[model samples]
Every structure is written in C-alpha cells, then in structure tokens.
Target: MFSKSSNETKIAVLEERLTSYEIMIKKIDEAIQIMGKTSQTISKMLAVHEEKLDNTHKNDELIIDRIKTMESKNTEEHHRVIERFEFIDSKINDRIEILDKKVDEVTKFRWLILGGVMIISFIFSQSSMVVDILTPDTDNVRIEKPR
Candidate 1:
C-alpha cells in the first residue's frame, strides 16, 4: 500500500507538469499569431512605400524629359536668332557698299563739273574779244573839246 501511494503521488505531479506545459504552449501559440499579424502589417506598409517610390521615379523621368525638351527648344531658338542676325548684317553690309558706290559716282560728277568750269574760265581770260567786250575801254577813251 505504501508503494501504491508513492506511484499515485508521482502521477499527480506529472499531470500538473503536463498542464503547465500545455499552458506554456498556448501562450507561445498566441505570440506566434500576434507576430504573424504584425508581419502582415509591415508587408503592407512596405508595399505602399514601394508604390510611392515608383510613382516618384516616374514623375522624375517626366520632369527630366520636359527639361531636355525645353533645352533643345532654347538651342534651336538661339540658332535661329544667330542666323537672322547674320542675315541682317549681310544686308547692312550690302547697303553700305551700294552707298559707297553712289558716293564715288557723285564725287566724280562734282570733279567733272569743276574741271568744266575751270576750262571755261581759262578760255574767257585768254580770249581778247571776250575780254574787250566784258571790260570798259578807259585807256582808249579820248575827250573832244567840240563834243
């Protein structure tokens, strides 16, 4: 009977230990469930962040493309302005050349007129009849008493 009582006490202690192990297993299961929920939430947040990053990258690409387009337009406009300026400069130079030619022609005409005037004056001065007709004959004038 003493051996039987000792066996019963051992069984009771083992049963109590088994109950404690079951409780511990239940708490670990609850912890595992909480960790799973937290992991799911973190995954969702990461997905959202990745999506936002993708959108930002897309917007950046669009902005860069727009900037490149603007740069190209500016370059084209600059080239056009330069070409126009060069064209205007050539036109101005051509007009200046034409004016110079006109001035040379006018100067030659003036010189020709001056030469003609000088020749006419020399001819008139050397001619005796012209000189006599143009000037008064004071030396040849004789005063008569009977006039």
Candidate 2:
C-alpha cells in the first residue's frame, strides 16, 4: 500500500509540469503572431517611402532638363547679338573712312584757292607801279604865261 501511494504522488507532479509547459508554448505562439504583424506594417511604410523618393528623383531630372534647354537658347541668342554688333561696328567704320576722304578733298581745295589769291594780288601791284613810271610827272611842269 505504501508503494502504491508513492507512485500516485509522482504521476500527479508530472501531469502538473506538462500543463505548465503547454501554457508557456501558447504564450510564445501569441508573441510570434504579434511580431509577424509588426513586420508587415514596417514593410508597407518602407514601400511608401521608396515610392516618394522615386517621384522626387523624377522631378529633379525634369528641372535639370528645363535648365539645360534655357541655357542652350541663351547661348544662341548671345551669338546672334554678337554678330549684330559686329555688323554695326563695320558699318560705322566704313562711314568714318568716307568722312575722312571728304575732309581731305575739302582741305586741298582751300589751299589751292589761297595760292591763287596770292598770285593775283602780286600781279596787280606790279602793274600799278609800271603805270606810275610811264605817266609823265605833272608835278614837275611849270605854268608859262603868253609873251
């Protein structure tokens, strides 16, 4: 009877330990399920961030393209303006050359007229001296009364 009672006590302790192990396993399963849900939520948030980053990158590319296009247009306009300025400068230079030639002609004509006037004045003075010598001196003649 003593042996039978010891065996019954051992069996009861083992059954209690099995029930505790089962309870621990159930809690672990619940924790695993919560962790899986949290992991799924984090993955969704990361996907949304990636999409936003891609959109931003695309917008930056578009802005760069627009800037490049504007730069190209500005370069073409600059070249055109330079060409126009060169043409204007050439025209101005040609006009200045023409004006210089006209001034030279006018100066030459003035010198010629001055030389002609000097010669004419000298000839007129010489002719007046000759006429005075040829004319008889009237101051030297004395008046004679009739005898």
**Model 2 over residues 1-147: C-alpha lDDT tens digits?**
569878888888888888998898899899888998998999998999999999999999999999999999999999999999999999999999999999999999999999999987777667967668766777776889999
Over all chains combined, what TM-score does candidate 1 have? 0.63
Give the clash count for each candidate.
0, 0
Alpha-carbon shift of residue 107 in model 2 (angstroms): 3.6
Worst 10 residues of 1 by lDDT: 135-144
Superposed by TM-score, candidate 1 places the C-alpha of residue 50 at a distance from the truth, in angstroms, of 1.5
lDDT of 1 by residue, 32-52 (tens): 999999999999999999999
Candidate 2, superposed: residue stretches over 4 Å from native: 1-16, 111-147
| Candidate 2 lowest-lDDT run of ten | 128-137
Q: What is the C-alpha lDDT of each candidate?
A: 0.97, 0.90
On the 0 to 100 scale, the lDDT of residue 75 in model 2 is 99
